[model samples]
Target: MSKDKKRADLDEKFQQLRSMTNSTSANKASILVKASNHIRKLKDKIEKLNQELGSTSTYPNTENEHQQDSFPKVNVETLENMFTVNVESEQNCPGLLLTIIQVFEELGLDVLNAEAACNDGFELAAQGVWNEGAESLDAEIVKQVVIEAIRKWMSGTASP
Candidate 1:
């Protein structure tokens, strides 16, 4: 079927399902029964179409994984200072603390103080240290790098 026709058919089926689901207080059991049956039939037909056209290719088509790589854009600012980050991960992942250390190393940043605890969830407390001769390094740059590195590590891409 043409794309337009397929979309229209899907829309019609969705409308039918919605109307059936919304039919309440009919004062008759038969109306509810009929609506339920119609909805079931529509669902079965949708499932069949999904199987035939392939779930990933048909309706509810989602973006490709490669297209969704960039996320949580970093905000850049002009300043020089040092800061700390405390990371907590609710998901059960082993050595989540080590992952943060790896990110700092990969980013070419010095970790002044670092500690981790991973009983309920992974928690990483870290202070990014910077010393540039007599003057300190840009604080904003340090903050941005540390924040970006933590975000990247969480998203499975810690390498720069």
Candidate 2:
């Protein structure tokens, strides 16, 4: 099928899904399951379309793609023996915060506090403490590693 036709069909299906989701005639569980299945089908169709178009990026590019940088802001601060990491992103990329937490865990750091929020964008902040006698837990190194990991993830080059 042509891309335009496929997109139009997908849009029509989405509208049907939205109507079903808002309908009061059916049981909520059944409606939810139907909606979920529709979403999965839509995702699969989108991926197929992307492949047909020879696009390598996982997410579709928005207009003005060159005008905005999607790279999230990452900041690391050290106070005494504690390290605080803050991340802000223009979009709510799924699993970003969890990946950051995993980075700390993989580095043998104890996360004392962690929080994430999303409105129009995503924000994650975490505080961690190193073990009393642990070596190679430098704040700068940890910060760099986290930054690199997030960059790789954003670029769709990270391992799943």
TM-score for candidate 1, residues paired by index: 0.35
Clashing pairs for model 1 are 80-138, 80-139, 81-139
- Count of clashes in candidate 2: 0
Off by over 4 Å in 2: 1-68
Q: Write model 2 residue lDDT over 66-154, tens digit each, in one string.
A: 52467677778876468888988888788777778777776667888888898778898888786554322445556666766776677
lDDT of model number 2: 0.67
Q: How many residue pairs clash in model 1?
A: 3
| Runs of candidate 1 exceeding 4 Å displacement | 1-81, 131-160
